[model samples]
Target chain A: MFIADCQARLAFDLLAHTWNPVLLWTLRHGPARPADLRRRVGGISPKVLTETLRRLEHHGLVTHRRYREAPPRVEYELTALGRTLLPAIEALGDWAHTHGDDVLAAQDRAR
Target chain B: MFIADCQARLAFDLLAHTWNPVLLWTLRHGPARPADLRRRVGGISPKVLTETLRRLEHHGLVTHRRYREAPPRVEYELTALGRTLLPAIEALGDWAHTHGDDVLAAQDRAR
Candidate 1:
């Protein structure tokens, strides 16, 4: 009998969000500031991105460096823990790319 | 600029639901009846399981067969496409098992 407290549930919950995987993928190259994230991850609003980043940070998957000199600068990067999810998410993305058409075909058949 | 109509989005959307992955995992061993699914997956209501199975079937992940005996019987099994997701989901489960504690610790720190 499994409840929501399971580790797998937690991981699934993190990936459940619409933008989390995309956000993680965008950060794969390296750290990026908020403006750059906005440009790269496209279609996510500034407010939503802030919220998502905060959630990821709280989950230990992302870290933000704040340079408190002159005009403060902040950049967000994936923590080692956060980077662990990249391969998992990429595997899923690959599966989706390769076999997603079958799912769509099934949907059409059901319709 | 990526939009909602992508394959990755579709895959993420499927896994975003709490029980979809679990239900799929439960079906990995072989075919089972609805009652067995309820007992194995635990905590999922009958209605939700039906909905989940229907969605998975629509997505071409599961198939149900009925036997027209004196006592009718129904069983659900994972399709080849459904089997494809098992490895991906297991990878996520593995990541969760390895790093879930870190996420919990981060949550504690955020508080």
Candidate 2:
């Protein structure tokens, strides 16, 4: 259906980002403050990290909770929908591990 | 494993493209000549389609066979590894069709 195409496109687009894994891996264990997530997903700048989180939040893949304190504390966590994608991502990881050689060979053949 | 991460990253990166579905859908039914594929994947420019096919071929997701004739004929088809990805794409499509509401709800909550 048209809606299915939209959803498929969205998921494919979302998972395509280099930083997505960084963000998902961070949330895999549990929620964390933005600073900590930035640390965990090395090589990401504050601007890029903030943008990535915002996009994830926008897509409903992650939740941002802001604490009311002298200095605001914001944390990000995977929502139920995001959690559902974990299995797929993990499956992809498994496939990548088990079939990397084949993929590499295919890559060579195509080249 | 290290190889898995690389493959996972590659697959994720490859699937992220908007044109990937268009290309795969074309190849899903059967092998396609470049011109026909370009026509089928509406809204795509010839250059972009060429680039996409090149990338797919480079990644071993597509195989391009050049025919010697009056006019050069380059036909593209899904390789074995590329065919393996069809199920994932179809699964995502089914999930999107059935669970779009859920994903939209999650999006609303995150906003």
DockQ of each: 0.64, 0.40
Query: Which candidate achieves the best TM-score against the true structure?
Result: 1
**Model 2 ranges off by over 4 Å:** A1-6, A69-71, A104-111, B1-6, B101-111
Q: Rate the local accuracy (lDDT) of all candidates.
A: 0.87, 0.70
- Global Cα lDDT for candidate 1: 0.87
Give model 1's docking category: medium
Give per-residue CA lDDT, model 2, range B1-111, as digits (tens): 222245566656666676775577568877888778766666678898888888887777788778999877778899877777776666555656666677677678766
* Per-residue alpha-carbon lDDT of candidate 1 for residues B3-97, written as tens digits (9 for 90 to 100): 44578877888887878898898888999999998888767899999999998998999999999987899999999999999988998888999
Model 1 chain A, poorest ten-residue lDDT window?
A1-10
CAPRI verdict (incorrect, acceptable, medium, high) for model 2 = acceptable
Q: lDDT at A49 for candidate 2?
A: 84
Among these predictions, the greatest DockQ belongs to: 1
Q: Weakest 10 consecutive residues, lDDT, candidate 2 chain B?
A: B1-10
Candidate 2 lDDT, A1-111, residue by residue in tens: 222245665666666676775577568888899888766666678998888888877777788788999788888898777777766666656666666678778677766
- Per-model chain A TM: 0.87, 0.77
Off by over 4 Å in 1: A1-5, A69-71, B1-5
B92: Cα error in model 1, Å: 0.4
